[model samples]
Target chain A: MKLINKRNFISIVCIFFTLITCGKLLYERALNFTDRYYTDNIFTILGFSVLITLILSLHFYLQKFPFWLVIIAQYALTVGIVFLAIFIHGRFSTNAPTAYWDMFVSITIPFLIGALVYYICFFVQIKRANKVLEKLNSEE
Target chain B: MKLIKTREENLEENYLELHYDKIDEETNAVLDRLRDTLRYIEGTYEDKKVTIALTDIFYIETVDRKTFAYTKDMSVEIKEALKDILEEYSKIGFVRISKSVIVNIFKIKKLQGDINMRVIIFLKNDEKLIMNRSYKNDFYKRLNDLKGRSAK
Candidate 1:
């Protein structure tokens, strides 16, 4: 399907980057405020970004997948990324919560936040698209 | 261009009569253009033949080697191949976004694209289609053409 417009794609990618970067900075600030500083190794940061970039690239490339499936897979990736970050910071067995409840909260919280951001972006795009469609219809 | 109106009580249904002397190639072409705009495509749907206006169709898809023209509520299999559909309506906003589908750009409601260069097209009727990367450029080119004309 040629449903993806190049201009829209480029714009979405730019927005996603901005959102993630801002999210990371705020998260770090919150951590510092709480005196629970998560170690930020340069290599670990690089790896995390790389893995996410690759997964998102794959998700976009496989555009035939249904929206729900994509969401599920993305949530799963979010869990995996959180685990990776915990492991890399060497706090998996130390500062981290080991109970199932804690783990569940950790994963679901970020997943919900991520989902919210995604849906917000989706709705914004929809509104923009509706305006564009209106223009196109007027021209017709 | 000129018009001459006359009241004729014998006319039953508002008859239109054209009076021209020494009609040239240009006039002949104009007649063809008028016919093309009012054209209907004869097709078959569910084993029954139907005629539909070309502009009313949302898109055309070739499934299982058979081509189908889809409107808001029905799908009619047309005798014309995919290539024929492209040749016929592309100039009027029909665009090929995949190997098997030619969507009317005017019918698309939303277009979202991601980093992988894939696009999701949302139709006004709520149907969604992914614009494969392979045909992405063509879709954009046609879209840009529409934008250009609109700008003018």
Candidate 2:
């Protein structure tokens, strides 16, 4: 296995921390919107979000495949994580069946937003690199 | 008993070995001629002193009516037009991949498809070059020819 450089390690840590904090605040807001509607397991939701965030970060950092693969993987992982969160919460209540569609929509919206953000970041990086290359070539 | 009686034994190697040596010699001579021609071209351009390895150059591009050679290390401005360079090096694996780009087929790391029939060429150094729609057919033909030659 390749050792992570200090810069990349720090970046990953920052990303992880930021995602966790935001996820916490969002979870709180979600709870406020429908009090006692979700499973009282904050840890489970946080765990799922962290897992998804790490996967997305890995995809972004490595970038082993083509751009299309990266985008597809990001969307798939985000959607999967959202469903996992709903499943984890729904397991504890008898009202789980009734909340299925509502849970789907709630989970999906955040993931779509996150995917769009990820894509924009990826595109911007590519554009910047291309511009640098163009400038270097132009100098010659 | 009959074999033992024969004055000359059977040849250990096949006749193909002799032909292979001749082909090798011919190939080496051709390569030498190509190198000499490239050296002559390099001598003609006095302003730019460049030693471009066949393996290092990813492609050549024309920008703002000036032609530049793009290598892994750096891009070098060439006084010669793209057509002149293409004429000289196309025989040695360089190919016109687009209107403004002529790529060394050996330096391509991977090929990716962009939207609307365009393709992106990823060089070994991680730089991306585009293959325009118009030159796609000719590009592939040249690429295939290089692959065929290499395989032999």
Candidate 3:
């Protein structure tokens, strides 16, 4: 599997951008922040998106292993990258330990949502393929 | 194109012929399927030559430069290259799913999606084949085309 191809890169960016935007909206609504706000660190978000894309592309390389193992590895890599990014941006030094926990929760929520969406799409595609297969088999 | 048929008493064999001004993609597909309909290859099993019908083959795989055709009950070593077989039978539902494996779409009982965009093919004979990620798109497209053809 070739990683970081144009098609996959575009897909990753789209999914990541949508997930981030929705997450931001949910966060603002929960906090009662009425004003439309965006993150100031555009580079951070872009860099994080690229890194996440690379990490997710690892799934193709590790396909020979069990599905559960691949999921666990991807999730762990995602969490690690998120925390590493936070640390590098100097947020770790200024925030309390509880703030780190909040960050972890934030990371986990979006990751879980992305995973769920992926699985749903994958299963739906498989179901359609199976239906076609059944029809073909019966025809024979 | 014109349709013509004739019934003859005590005919020894049946024959079909086509006369066309030019061959297009659709015409080529029809010709290939016509060729595939009566296709058979000589294979070796237990040091004996066996005539294997193309329709009875579930899949073909090449291992260490030796190509083998697998049927529901037996495997036979064939002299034909995988590439030639696919070129001849692709219009009849044979598709390459990996570097070394060509599977008969009609022989596939079902398909399951594996992690990382790979596909697991379940054959009617209770065997499994993993479709490579690179070939997944072509496989799906071919399968969809076959489905449309069947619907028609």
Off by over 4 Å in 1: A1-40, A81-114, A135-140, B1-53, B70-76, B79-88, B96-101, B107-148
* Model 3: lDDT to the true structure: 0.78
Q: Sort the predicted structures by lDDT, highest score first.
A: 3, 1, 2
Give one digit per residue, the lDDT tens place, for model 1 in A38-109.
343333334444454445555546556655577679768766766765665555445445533444464566
DockQ scores for all the models shown?
A: 0.14, 0.01, 0.49
The value of fnat for model 1 is 0.26
Question: Candidate 2: misplaced stretches above 4 Å?
Answer: A1-140, B1-48
lDDT of 1 at A84: 62
Q: Candidate 2 — which pairs collide?
A: none
What is the per-residue lDDT of model 1 for residues B8-76, given as tens digits with 9 covering 90 to 100?
887776555667897778677656655654578999888888999877788889999999989989999
Per-residue lDDT over B2-32 for candidate 3, one digit per residue giving the tens place of the 0 to 100 score? 5478788998977787888898887787776
Write candidate 3's Cα lDDT for A18-84 as tens digits: 7666766677799988632144334445666677788777766775676666777887887787777
Please give the fraction of native interface contacts (Cα pairs under 8 Å between A and B) kept by each candidate: 0.26, 0.00, 0.51
Residue ranges of candidate 3 with Cα displaced over 4 Å: A1-4, A7-11, A34-43, A91-93, A96-99, B1-32, B112-120, B130-135
Full-model lDDT, candidate 1? 0.68
CA shift at B72, candidate 2, in angstroms?
Answer: 1.5
